[model samples]
Target: MNEREKGGVPDDALIRMTLAGDDGAFGELVERYKGRAFAVAVGIVGDGDDALDVVQDSFIKAYYKLKEFRFGSNFYTWFYRLLVNQAIDRWRKSARSAEVPFDESWLAEDSSPPDGFAYPRTPENLARDRELGDALQRAVDALPEYHRAVIVLREVDGMAYDEIAKVLGCSVGTVMSRLHYARGKLRETLKSHREG
Candidate 1:
């Protein structure tokens, strides 16, 4: 029985219900954020199968650890941090293994075709934007893991600076500074690609 099935209350109410042993309340949280959480894992791991595993495991971890969850902190913030950690671990394992089957085709099906979601109308603009997007991805991947995490959470995820501070267990100023530096590097990398 979902809240939607019964005309819901606030998310915090659902959390309280789940804490009080209503299994459906936890299901509501899962159903709501599963897609976004999976997408975040995929974006970091760059592998569909691994992303799925990460999402499932992260959710299980969250559920068992719910008692430790403090009120006033965003649930998604904790979830995102867990997803990022799982992706990093998978990335490290894939790096060390020689026969892990590296192919972009699977990622391609999940990622996009050339015209998937871009705003370009002209062929030339389309090509240029794609070049920038590819360059941006490469630059982002090259960043230190923590720097990359902060930039993606702040810039890409559009999480508030305070939220990111909580997620990363850092001060808001630290989050801002990391994001500033990461964006500067991305800009420099992109400029060289476009100009040359």
Candidate 2:
């Protein structure tokens, strides 16, 4: 059984139950979305610990704001809006404070690259691939916050344009524009890195 089936309640039903004073219903919501939320958060904040904080804070905010949620809308989209905004804010604060260290540990953990390519078997190729991955990540980090969000939401999460537009509180056109600009910038940065 899927999680919702196992829980025996849909998200709206769970929200209603929570509104009726069943805290467990809300807990189920958290359990359902926390992993995906963390992935999105990490993609934006680029730091696992900060991403954790962002997820926790977003959940807490979501809990308090549950009453404001319009029934029948996708709960994840609403929650994702909060999560993305929180991540961007956190990223901005960290960026302004000092250099935010890029964590390469995630790179090591995944056997394949984010682009779905298998890692090179040879040691030399592996090292070069690692360098390319590092450069790509650094290029992504250098993107503006909204551009980063757009790229991560589209590329990493594979969210549809309309869904991303909803999450980012932008029009579909804006989402497309940001994504185009972000990709162009990354290409330019990576090209310069290669040529240099």
Candidate 3:
């Protein structure tokens, strides 16, 4: 079948197909979204190894619970919520604390940024982006769980407020409020890095 003939052929549609005995369709969905899902996982758990485990578990959970997923809703928003809960569970299992990564051992040692990302991709600029990303991540990690969730959903996931509200099981007002505070705190924390 051509792309259009494959129904709407969206990720959700593929998932529905998977539920209907098309394992290949499920594999397609995994190939399509695994990178994004992994990025979200890493962003949350702050460790490459742990994030990989989360991503694997997330795929398993999504597959088994495919029947439970509501139709006509944003697939990614739903998936993101599942990821957040999974990451939180993993965190609780390991740390038994709600504190973000900076205050924890995960981030304490890596005073330097990642290997590369100055995304001018020049050595200096890449180093700067990594520095900023690292510092920004620390501040982001410090947000209250709800606020952090909103900011990540909105900014990183590019989810609309309504979608985020749906994922978060909160009102748009609550999403906006948490987002406002989250942004304000992030700005305050990263002020030194901002350009004039």
Superposed on all Cα atoms, the candidates' RMSDs to the truth, in angstroms, are 5.5, 3.4, 7.1
| TM-score computed on alpha carbons, candidate 2 | 0.84
lDDT per residue (tens digit) for residues 63-162 in model 3: 8888998888877877777887887677556663222233223234355546883323355755565677778887876777677777877887777989
Name the best candidate (by lDDT): 2
- For model 3, the stretches where C-alpha displacement exceeds 4 angstroms are 4-8, 96-126, 192-196
TM-score of each: 0.76, 0.84, 0.75
Clashing pairs in 1: none
* lDDT over C-alpha atoms for residue 95 of model 2: 44
How big is the RMSD of model 3? 7.1
Q: For candidate 1, lDDT tens digit of each residue in 34-146? A: 88777666556655688789889888888888888778877888777777787778766776321223333433435564665654356575566566666777777777766
lDDT of each: 0.74, 0.86, 0.74
lDDT of 2 by residue, 1-196 (tens): 8666587688999999899998989999999899989888888888888989999999999999999999989998999999999999999888442223444554465546658666656768656666777677787888889999999899978899999999999899999999999999989988987898
